[model samples]
Target: MYQQILAPLFGSLGWSAVAAALPLLVLFALLGLVRMTAWKASLIALAVALAIAMFVYPMPVDQALLSATLGAAFGFFPILWIVINAIWIYQMTVTTGHFDVLQRSFSRISGDRRIQAMIIAFCFGALLEALAGFGTPVAITTVMLLALGISPMTSAVVALVANTAPVAYGALASPLVTLASVTELPLADLGAMTGRQTPLLALFVPMVLVGIIDGVRGVRETLPATLTCGITFAVAQFAASNYVSVPLTDIIAALLAAGATVLLMRVWTPRGAEPPTSEPAGSRAEVLRAYAPYLIIIAVFVVAQLGPIADLLDAVTLKFNWPGLDIRDAGGEALSLTEFKFNWLSGAGSLLLIAGLLTIPVIGISARAALGRYAATYRQLAWAIVTVMTVLAIAYVMNTSGQTATLGTWMAATGGLFAFLSPILGWLGVAVTGSDTSSNSLFGALQVTAAEQAGIDPMLAAAANGSGGVLGKMISPQNLAIAAGAVGMAGREGDLFRRVLPFSLGFLLLMCALIALQATPVLSWMTVM
Candidate 1:
């Protein structure tokens, strides 16, 4: 192994680091070029990663496998837990007919396809991203846009793009919580810096989403609404993350945007000819019944996740760290690794259960139908869960194995242009797996380290890692599968990726520009001007 993988390379490096990294580069190359399915790619990557750890990096094999297993399990349950429940809640709305009201409500706000896409997928979805993120916004907003007669491709694109601005604060700001715990940056400081950094991205998101949907004309027409949503979202993200705990930022931000947009849409009509009229409204009682469960879920989720009563429930949490995966600080000191344990009482999963209960009575969902739908949504999410687990396992291995360090060392050699290259690393992460959570988990720490080494502010760089990563979501193999599954576009995943690549590249450029601004003294303009 050393002869073929290490000797000549080591000669140049004067060490075995070269041998240690060959496996990693090969794994990434094969995945990038072969267009292999995620499962296969993850397996291959894991295998090479294992080999590197044991032979080159000298990590114990059992320990390596155990770490990978624990990481995989974490990816499968709670992460997948969020995705499945989010889809189920939306499915519950659809199966019970409340979706029609949702569609009409969106249309009444702005019937133009572009504006509607911006509102539902961009602004509204960002709110959801802030609230329940993971895959929730995409599942809900895409379905709603489709219900409103937007093309399936358009809906998926809009949802994926809108997913960007709110991700750091998503699912009640879990990302920031994770970032804080890992970095030991004051949660408030990280939250505040992320808030300051992300709203900067938020400012441009609506303009990007609208331009994508209907071009300059559409952007111009919906400028008022777009600007309002972006500013509101940015300002809220800045304040919520700065003042409040990270865990509640997304929840509060999303709810505020939803409430504000809902209230505003009542009186704020937009310019241009609206689309075709939607069907008449459903009975108020029917709408109320249809939505009761979701209301309960949100209510319970909010109270349990935060609020005065949360401590009582939170007292019953499941907490522990994965043993044997001690990471390092900037120096050689080992960083404490605590993967927050699942708390059944206060965990997001429990809130989902609460939502379902409140929803069942309100929607008049028969117990039989509710059980059937819940089961079906689980089945739908199972493979996705597997995919996330598999990919995350590989990612965790690479991260803990110091493989990312090996890679980061090589990349950081490009001193001045590191800002430009930074986004690609984030992009490749999300491109491999659909969810930004997965991407951020895979690279968030790496970005921080890279930023510090490159003499850049870690928060600006970390936020760019997130914002740039969002562009890849549209083309992620998992996302393609979901959208295709939703619209019967299966077996044509390649076609969809091919179609979306240009837009993906374009938006990535926009994000890259935003990230570069942070490093450049001139970027004060992007923030101030």
Candidate 2:
């Protein structure tokens, strides 16, 4: 088996770390500075990473190729698979003319652009994040925001930003679960600490969404509703994660947040906001029919996640060790190097596809037309698929070649200030991998290790990894591609990244401060014992 060499070329950790980071820097410069399309930038970055893996890190050629292939397979099977089918269901609704009715139903709730954003992007998006995650919220919510007459760019930005708070607990709290597993901490402790940290962001995000949607006026006029949504969500999140159930944290929080927003609107309307021009109310049957697609989605996802059904579906899962990619870390611990966990039956993508197929008869579309829509979606998402795959391949290369470990090892040398720097590792992990769960798996142990060295609570440090990583989702290449596709801005992933970068960085800084304070006596009481 070929082993990775962290400082293969320069024999210096500092120079090796910089060499390891060159591909990511190239990717960011190309996408953020040179304004390259995501697909092209990803391709170039993958090329750079391969060269670095083979030369600077000195990974064998066969291992490098297999790693990239495995990453691409994973990108297609689960990640892009979910994106394609979720958008296909939305397209099916549009084809059947139900989307218009759905839009009217939402407008009936509130005509104000700000309120619509709060409902669709913040509240409803959280529900999606809970159920499906992995770009599902960005894919679905951006489209919904567009249907409500928001600009495509604004819709994409709002969806990305609103997706943050729910993400630590997303996919049934998979990120926290991964953190617990990696750090050997109790799930309850990790959940509670994450609960403490992310709820602060939960309480702040709705206001930020409003600010993004309509500037100072939006925040000023909709202050009551925004505060209500954020505070209720935060309280519910903390209670659910700490006391009730970790997996159901986002779901319960989302339901309560939406309910609170509706109740608040019953007595208060924002000043200067005109009532939406009343549209003809559909019959109860018509409204339910219009919502049948989502109802089907909920049913399929729920059934698929049921214990027995999930077990049966998981039985069909295909797991394989990546060839020639196994490597050990500095401490002689073997890295968990595997690839393409093809959860064919139980995956969210399959559930979404089942939901779309069920929609065909409900929405009055023939099989032929539904197939046509599927093909059209494939054509539209062609570049996005390539972008995701290439980026993931780059991530795989970085991980297998020890480049990621190099960066983390260098960061872990921060000593006492490692508390402030802990979340940055998480942020970097997710920004590179496009997944909070993946980030936790990558850096969870590192956080605990660094915390022990620096004399801080390992639980708090590990939780910070997950909590802060959520911010990076907004600017991740996979998310940018999904957001671009959702808004019909296929080649403009760069634009979406640029729009969300400020919010991502701003939240990262806030999380750093929160984590830093928790490490000290000032906010030590905030953490779970």
Candidate 3:
């Protein structure tokens, strides 16, 4: 078996870290500075990563190529699987003329665009995030905001920013579960620690969303409603994750936050509220028809994920060693990632596909028409498919070739100062992988190992990895492609990237400060320990 090495460049951790970072630097420069289209930039970056894997890290050429193919397969099966079906459901609603009816129904709740954004993008988006993480929330919510007359770019930005708070508990706390498994830490402690941290971010996310939608004036005008939603969400998230259940945290927080906002709107109205001009709101029956698809999705997921059903699904899941590629760590242990788990029937994409089929009759569409829409959806997402697959390929090549470990190892050399940089490592992970779950998997054990060496709390460090990774979601190439595609701004991903990058960095800094403070006696009590 080929073995991984931490410092392949002159046995110097510092130089190896810089060499390992070139692929990512090339990626960001192309996307951010050069403003290149996402697919082209990703392809270029993938080439750079392959070069580094073969020459810099000196990995076998065949193994490096095989790793990329595996990642590409994964990116399609699970990641793109969710996005394509979710968007197809939205397309079905549009085809049935129910989407416009849904828009009018939302306006019937409140005329203020800002309040509607608070409800749809922030509150409702969290519900989607909880149910189906990955790019599902971003793709679905951006289109929803656009339906309500928000500009495409603004809708995408709002959706991306709003997706953050619920992510630690997203897909029923998958990220926390992954972190727990990787670090061998208590799942409850990881959940509890993350619950404490991300809820603080939750407290301010609505306001940030308002500011994005309507500038500082939006925050000022809707202060009461924003405060109400943020407070309720933060408190409920903290309570559910710590006291009740980890997986239920986002569901509890989202429903309460939405309910609280609806209640606030009853007693208070914001200035400059303009009702959306559309056809009259649909009848109760039509409104129910309009909402049936999303309700069906939630039902399908809840049923599939519960007790015996979830167990049966897992039993059918095929886990096998990846073909023709085997590499061990520096310690000579086989890599777990070398094995691929194919959850064909139980994957969220398959569930979404099932939901799409169920939605056919509910929305008065036939199988023939639905199949046509499905084909069209595939054509619509063609480039997004390429962008996502290539980005995941780049991630796998770097990971399998030990570029990621080298960087993490170099960063961990900072001793006690590693606590402050812990979140940055997590941020970088998600920025590359476009997944908090994947990020925690990549860096969770590294964070805990570094924390132990530095005499800091491992739980705090691991939780920080997940918390900071959430912010990086806004900048991930896969997310940018999804958001851009959702709002019909495909080639303008760079614009969306530029719009959201500042907030991503600013929020990451806040998370870093919070994590650092928690490592000290000042805020050490906040950790679950």
TM-score top scorer: 3
User: RMSD of model 2, in Å?
Assistant: 1.4
Off by over 4 Å in 1: 1-37, 51-58, 211-224, 235-272, 275-279, 321-340, 413-508, 524-529
If the candidates were sorted by their lDDT against the true structure, best first, what order would they fall in?
A: 3, 2, 1
Q: Residue 80 of candidate 1: its Cα lDDT?
A: 64
> What are the RMSDs of all candidates, in order?
4.8, 1.4, 1.4
lDDT of candidates 1 onward, in order: 0.64, 0.88, 0.90
- Write candidate 3's Cα lDDT for 368-388 as tens digits: 878888888888888889999
Better of 1 and 3 by lDDT: 3
Q: Candidate 1 has which clashing residue pairs, if any?
A: 130-250, 172-247, 289-363, 293-358, 293-359, 297-355
lDDT of 2 by residue, 105-181 (tens): 87777778789888889999998889888988889889989988889999999999999999999988889888888
In TM-score terms, candidate 1 sits at 0.80
Task: Tell me the deviation in Å of residue 65 in model 1.
Answer: 2.7
TM-score for each predicted model, relative to the true structure? 0.80, 0.98, 0.98
Quote the positional error of residue 206 for candidate 2 in Å.
1.0
Identify the candidate with maximal lDDT.
3
Cα misplacement distance, residue 175 of candidate 1 (Å) = 2.2
